[model samples]
Target: MRVFYAVVLLAAVLVLNFSLMHLAPGDVADTISQSMGGADQEILDKIRADYGLDKPFLVQLGHYIGRVLQFDLGHSFFFNQPVTQLILQRLPATLLLVISAQILALVLGVVLGVYSARKPNSIANYFVTFFSLFGYSAPVFWTGILLLIAFSLKIPWFPVAGMRDVTISGGFWIQFWDVARHLVLPMITLSSIFIALYSRLSRATMMETLGADYIRTAKAKGLSNRQVIYKHALKNSLSPVITQAGIQFSAMMSGAVLVEAVFSWPGLGTLAFQSIIARDTPTILGILFFSALVVIVGNLLTDLALRLVDPRVGGRK
Candidate 1:
């Protein structure tokens, strides 16, 4: 089954990731020892033994994989907290930002794409195509910086960095609004590329759908333009868009690392970045496996959406 294949592939990727992390030049014990101001050899060896770093590579890996299967990601050397606890705390903020951006991209992308398809050779279509390329090609961190300068510093409309104002503390609603206020810049930064991509994809899909015989027949039978486009063409065109959206969502979740770091947003990406720097293998592996799970689940959801949109796809080999 497709699900079984996906799970097997994900498991392989996780194993490879674990091996590569171990094979990296420095051991976690060495990193910890160095950070602790040149501890004595005996003490360093004790610390290594305490954390199982003194074990053979295969033994360490086996224990790690076993613990992971048991949902025990172990404690973070840097944070002194369980990796799952840390990730769960930060995941919502990242999800809020990315999911909102995705919605914006889908709505704007579909609308602009449909309009461009309706007038393929028109100036509006040309302009949309040109701008989409520019948006897609832009660097996310650079874009975040520009938005920070333009809106946060220059215009003074939003916070320059961090997830929320440190001073605001009252109730859930107050906290939520504060977080939302700071989220605008990073959301826009993340959404820009997706918007461009969705627009281009939607335009292509719509264009193809418009050229289909069914669309022409519907138009010839005297259906209104809106009805023909919406009721018929849009429905069929959505399959591809749904697929792209799923993939894009997965990419955004992983790729938000740079954007989160730039904006100082507390999210899995930032957490993962810090973990990598600190050589916190538990946190790093936790994030890697979590991200893979998200991508797989997203793809599954996309398949379900496709089936709902067009049942023929569900029935096909």
Candidate 2:
């Protein structure tokens, strides 16, 4: 049943994405002509026909859906490359940003949450609460720009942009840290909101867990305060946090566009930005297709993960 829904949803997404691409202003042929210093009408018409832009919208969409089922994403008009190849090339950089941010956010948020929950009245608790509110509420682009100025410009700790230094030559590990160093700022910007959200959620859920009847029973059995938290409360509190993490993963992917543009990071988001400016319909639709598919699949996996973490969700299974 779930598989059926997933297939139907992806089909609907394909249709809508194709229709909306046509609705966007300026076709690729026009951009091409303008780049050619206002090329003659005959050239423009030939370009359109060559790219199947002259076809009826329904016919084009039908052909597109067929190609998608065959796992072909078409070519990029602007980049002159296969869509799959381009996406594959940029995918690793984006994955590094996304994965790093998730891990950092999860670790920092959970740690801060646990400490705050254990020391409700301490200065550290107040500071964490204040930081979370600020982190979550601020605009991501704004936060990214501020960090770029303070850390990249003034402090000069990390490079301003790009996945790695083209000049850096060494063995694999040396190249690896170069990219990691460049990633630090973007990762922090990408994860700040999630970290803030997770911290507050963990605190709230932990408080409830600590007050539960089972917690009291454990304490009555002579379990220490530390054991009550580590053995009993922490695991249950993490169920909601894990679910939230999955949901945030989708949002973070979409939001990476702004960060990528700001820092000139070479990722899918950067590709999307450049494609839009060039009026590259195929590339734009490709990105939309990927984003929609990822969100749906991510949500499904989140459900499965939540079920594993909390057996109440799985029930008989």
Candidate 3:
């Protein structure tokens, strides 16, 4: 039943995306023509016809939907490469950034949250709360620039832009190190907001769980502090954290456009931004669908994880 709903939602998203793109004032051919010094009407019409833009909306949408089902996203107007190829080339870098940011956020946020919950109303809790607010409120691009200036320019600890140094060449380890070096600034920028949100959410969830009857019963049973927190409170606290993290993951994947453009990370967000400026419909649609898939998959995985963590949830539905 869940799988069925997922399919229906994805289909609706695809249709909405196709209709909106088609309804836009100008087609890809018009965009291409204007960029190329204003081609004659005949030439523009030919380009449109070649790209199937001349077809009626339903027919074009039908062809597009059929092709997508077959794993074909069609050609790119600007890059002169398959849309799939362009996406694949950029996907790894984006994934690396997103994954790194997520890991940092989860680990640090969970720890801080747990600590804050344990030490509620103490100075440490207050400090964590204060810092979280700053992290959450700061703008991503501004944060990136500040990090660039302080770390990259002032401290000279990291490079300002690009994924690698021009001097480095060959070997997997060397390439990995280079990518890591460039990733630091962007990852930190991307992670700050998520870390703040996660910390708050975790702290809240943990505090509530700590006050639960099971936790008090465990305490009465003379369980060690660590066991009470870890085995009793923490496990129950995870459902909400997992739910928030799943939703945040999807948002980060789609919402990193500004950070990607600011940092020039060559991720899907950057690609989508460029495609929009160029009015590259295939690339834009590709990104939208890819992002939707990520969100859906992330949510599904979260649900599964939640069920495993607490079988009661699985039995409920």
| Reference-based lDDT, each prediction | 0.87, 0.89, 0.88
What lDDT tens digits, residue by residue, belong to model 3 across residues 139-230? 88999999999998999999888888889998999898898899989998999999899999999999999989999999999999999998
Cα distance off (Å), candidate 3, residue 94: 1.6
- Give stretches of model 3 more than 4 Å off: none
| Candidate 1, lDDT over the whole model | 0.87
Candidate 1 lDDT over 1-317, as tens digits, reads 88998889788877898899888876667778888877788988898899988899899888887888888878888899998898889888777877888888888889989999999999999999997998899999999999999998889999988888988899999998998899888888888898899989999999999999999999999999999999999999988988899989877886588889999998888998898988888889888888887778878888898899997986577
Pairs that collide, model 1: none
Ranking by lDDT: 2, 3, 1
- How many Å off is the CA of 183 in candidate 2? 1.1
Candidate 2 wrongly placed segments (more than 4 Å)? 315-317
Every model's TM-score = 0.93, 0.95, 0.94
Identify the runs in model 1 with alpha carbons over 4 angstroms from their true place.
Answer: 170-172
The TM-score, computed over Cα atoms with residue i paired to residue i, of candidate 1 is 0.93
